[model samples]
Target: MLTNYHTLKNLIIQIKPKLIHSQIVEAFTQEKDTLHIIIAGEEASALELNATGQGYIFLRPKFERARKNSLDIFPEIFGDEIRDVLIHKADRIIEILLSSGLKLIFQFFTGKVNFFLLNQKNEIIASFKNPKDNIGKIFESEKKDSNYDLMLSDFNAFKDVWESNKIENPVLRFVKSVDTIDMLTAREILHRAGELEAGRIWKALVDVGAELENPKPRIYYEGSFPRYFSIIELTHINLRKIEFDDINEAIRKFVIETRVSKSYRDEKKTIETKLNELVEKRKRTIEKVIEEIENNQRAQQYEVYGSILMANLNLIEKGLEEVELVNMFSEKGEKIKIKLDPSLSPVENAQMYFEKAKKTKASLKIAQERLERLKFEIKQLENLLDELALCENFDALKKFKEKNLEELKKFGIVKDKLVAKVGGKFKRFIVDGGFEVWVGKDAKSNELLTFKFSDKEDLWFHARGTSGAHVVLKTGKRQPSKKAIEQAGSIAAYFSQARTSRLVPVVVTKRKYVRKPRGAPEGTVAVEREEVIMVEPKLPSEEIE
Candidate 1:
């Protein structure tokens, strides 16, 4: 655990950076509490730190070695600015003073590991955790050098303070005494002495306190995983002590490994969340589009009014702003109101209603077509979501990210990239007789398979008068056997709307006969010279490679 006081002390010594002042090249946040800071100097190094829990500080490798995409969440505060790296002589905090006098403080104390970047006027700039309560209210003024000293004089002062005050918690009392030791080290000292009272553990505490003056860093591990690191030798028998010439190297490897694992988990969570949100939003869009199409269809009533006005021209007079006439199309012959333009003649007004009816009919057509396109897009997004669910490793997730990130960018789910087209590949299946059959997974794939990938002579099959995949059988310019054609028909039927039907009719034709009309929706096509076959919707029993 990096919260140990001795651990931070050893880490600072091990780093021993030659340059105290360096420019902040960039800063990238892996998650909410973890970040990577790049400092440029004669020998540049990237420093990694986590503040939420199990936090550690180490010299990380270059940006290329980073496993996840680097997000510039806070680009304005930490980029290309010179900062003074100040490791306080005291063991509690590491401060990075910026050119603008803002100090980025990394406090590595137990139960309160946090990062706080504060302005020169002591106002908080940015923090990792609860800034108002956890950081701002609790920060105490720095004590004198004598208070932090681990020698006999400071020990006497702690002894006087302990005797005069009535503190119940032993760990809190120890912190007030030494002003630098954490709870873990305090508990370790008491455990080594086999005592709970302060008086009884005095000798062991002094010995451990003296070791802090001359540090010997050691990392404790549990079965190849780093569990705890400290300057004093660990007392537990189960833990294996890993000795390192430089503790910085040890902390670096351990923190990097932990970060790599956490980064993937966070990335996967982000993808899953975006996919879920898009699915829900697209569903709402489809519903709203359908409602709009229905409203446009209701505008067909404009035609009936125009017909009524034409039938009752004698009832209208010159300069009549409005008219009341029987709606002949209605079964009850109800009187309807027809607003008129006083400047236009009765005939021209009737023509105006006729023109409005025509425009409404055209609007209805456009709305229906738009609704179909929206539904197709929803289907495509659902297919993409299924593929994301099957992403079991980093490489799969990475490919999904690279391909579908632009789709998410449309909704501002991921905003740092240009728009690009993405879709799942076609599903391939092997049928009997060693023939290869390809099935379209979605609307886009259907068009791709039928027009772009399939050969002119290849046999194509689809469920008759229904929405389904375009199934292509690779005939290789040779006529397939009756069994292969029948099997392909079954696959085509199974992927269609009639999948549950006892018998489905599938239309079979050559690829050259399937022509997509200009500006048509995906997967829609006109067929010529088609042959219909009746088959039960089912998968082939045995598929060969």
Candidate 2:
């Protein structure tokens, strides 16, 4: 409890001597949750009040002013002479009264730091943070009669709270039940009391209570990094202790060392996490590219099929699913079966295979180009990681993040979520002609996919006789190709309970025709209209988005 009642009471008593006749030069903020007020008297001093996740106030020795990125606030208080400084009751609020009758209140509640300026009437005129909430309200301390002060005042009061507190460890209980007692004080008292029965917890409380009235502040360190600051002698922790003549000096040094180091470590960890995600994404992309390159090896085989179809064009009949013909490139002259679209004529079918051969050849070239570029990008990412690993300070880590933020975001790292996907519980895939196919992952999502996520014209699919994902082919306004419908059908089969079957019948219908029956369980839907399509249960190799 660095900003505890007694500590702050002492802090104000000590700091008042310096600020008593000081003239208010300026008050400003350079960052969030922090404010600096520059005052001049016999000596120029700056009070840095930081209400971080934890609240702390430190006195910087000089009248140091931030050169840039600083905005002036409380300009009305300028040139006012400081008359008195006092703690509000037993709470962690400091009241600074000026000669002009304006009062500046600094409330240092944990996780809630608020600065307020009040008039002679005690009505708030302005505030540093949320002005609308504080303005015109008569400001007051929240814990004016809080239980912490009563617990410290008498033994019976302490015991009453101690027994009511459910925390098994008295030390942890003290920190949780008492607002002012922090972990450092609790642990020190526990250490000094040795082993105390439930009835004798009062003995442990005595040491800490006495220490609070009379503090001997010091900073504790591990190796070169400052770990903690305390007013009591922390014998429980074995660490290097640097004693300070003044509690303010101890707090200043501890806050600077620990918080700065924490910032550096936190920033470095974020960079490392993003870099690792980038490297993994690049590696996965490489694998896909490599697979595409391997698939391109069948380009000559497609060409052979095209040549054979063209050669036997006269012999081939229309409406045939497959035609057995002598292979043009087969060593043994073995007859091969080539599948065709029954709707297309013999000549059109032959040209389709030829176009497939041409596209596959071009795709091979593109894949090779993409692979080389990916390798170069991966190398660059690795170099960035190496440089980041060597960064020694917060500034160095910050500079590295600034330099590579764009590159990281380009690869889909945005803040805490890496490569955030489209908001849904469904797996999405894109088919030929940019058709988006959505497949539900569970029963609840299946209900959402069929009725909520799909439009009236969207095509929905499900395995005919077994449980399956409700698949939607999002072909808004455009009629889906037969191939696209078949792809969606394959996805429906693959996601169904009958996926292992060689061929599964999938029911296809407009989303408008599908309805959840009244009193039906989740994922159970009735179809007013449906058409069955049979297909091999094989999904597209493309990654789900």
Candidate 3:
């Protein structure tokens, strides 16, 4: 509810336990001739001035403690003529009230005065009014004694009624007590009490009484209620302090996790490189050993062939010795063969050579097979290492490890014991108990907060008629308080263009009312059956910290 005139009036009536203090420090006239009244107590104010030349009435409080220089009221209406007149009249009234400590001072032209009285709450109560001829009479009748006591009669009436009298303000007292009496009935009573003689003023007061019944808090511009301004009460909770601690913790955890993952990735990469280098070195060594064995085998084969040729030569030499007579007839044709040494005889040499060759072949085959198996084993190791390298980081490694663990259960590689963070760092939890509120920083985040995370029962809020981040209150099973709603609304307003605005309008609705059309952009949604709250954005104390 924007604090329009009607709403302000309603609030005043509802919380009618204390003094109503209205200080109009400034005013503005819109192009539509509506008067905007900026009050000090209220964050923002507005009023509509009529197009007609006649001006509106404004009433102010007259208090005893008011200083001579305290009233700095100014008229900010459109025309210089009326503006000058209003400024002059306000100055005169302030002067009179300051000098005489008058409880009521009338602006004769506008037919309004400053009224001050005490309420049940012992708070200063005040309002604006038109000067009534029967005001003295009304004041007299309200008092038991006929003395001309201003404070003792009007202000003290509420305080003196009961020891713990709750009706301390005059307006509240009047509203609460005078139920049966009509306006005329009360006027007649006042007429007789003070012996008022001015009929015209009395009639005007009677008309003012009607206006006060449902007083819309507005600035009077051109003698009429052109633009109505209201006062809206915004209730909010202080959750920034609580959320700040949680967010800090979340950020800390996120940073730690990120660092750890990066470190693990770096370490894994180093291990993979070292393992690959070792495997390649082992493969080259095995290949060299196989080549050496092949060379040794070829050398043994050549030795066997030499041994066979030497054995054949020894047999030819023995035959030549027996046939010496034939050599004389054919000396040119005779083959001269030298006898081989007995220590290097053919049979003994062949046995020695065969044994060496057999032994060499056996050893070479065994070494080659062993080398081949080792190379195959190394290849398998390299493949496994390659896979491990692709795991990227600890998070991925952990997932893979977990999966492998399940598989390893069949082979019994290790026992099962899972230890890991169950949720991500960015995951949100409830604050102020189990209210599922989600906050986001931007449009994309807002979309994620509402559509992706928020439940149907959650309520959504945003600054109305402006761009703002979306805020969702997760009302799981609990009813939201006025304070909580206000706090969320403040967040929505604070993150919006209207953050600097005096009073920002925030629209809130249940999640059910919010809908996203097909193919709509992020954070774009339609809503129905929502409430509007106007509030000044107040940053949490913790936020400043």
Candidate with maximal TM-score:
2
Q: In candidate 2, which residue pairs get closer than 3 Å at backbone N, Cα or C atoms, i.e. clash?
A: none
Tell me the spans in candidate 1 whose CA falls farther than 4 Å from its real position: 14-16, 28-30, 64-84, 87-91, 97-102, 109-177, 197-200, 260-445, 448-534, 537-545
Tens-digit lDDT track of model 2 for 138-240: 9877665666656666778777776788877767887776666767777777677776554455676765778767888878877667877777778889999
On lDDT, the candidate that comes out on top is 2
Candidate 1 lDDT score at position 203: 68
Clashes of 2: 0
Candidate 3 lDDT over residue span 53-150, tens digit each: 22222222221322332332223211111111111211212111121122322122222223322223322233233223323333311123322122
**Per-residue accuracy of model 1 over 118-193 as CA lDDT, tens digit each:** 7666666566667556445434436435354543345456556666656678767666666567777877776776
Query: What's the lDDT for all of these models?
Result: 0.71, 0.81, 0.44
TM-score of each: 0.50, 0.59, 0.24
Clashes of 1: 0
lDDT of 2 at 173: 81
Candidate order, TM-score descending:
2, 1, 3
lDDT of candidate model 3 versus the reference: 0.44
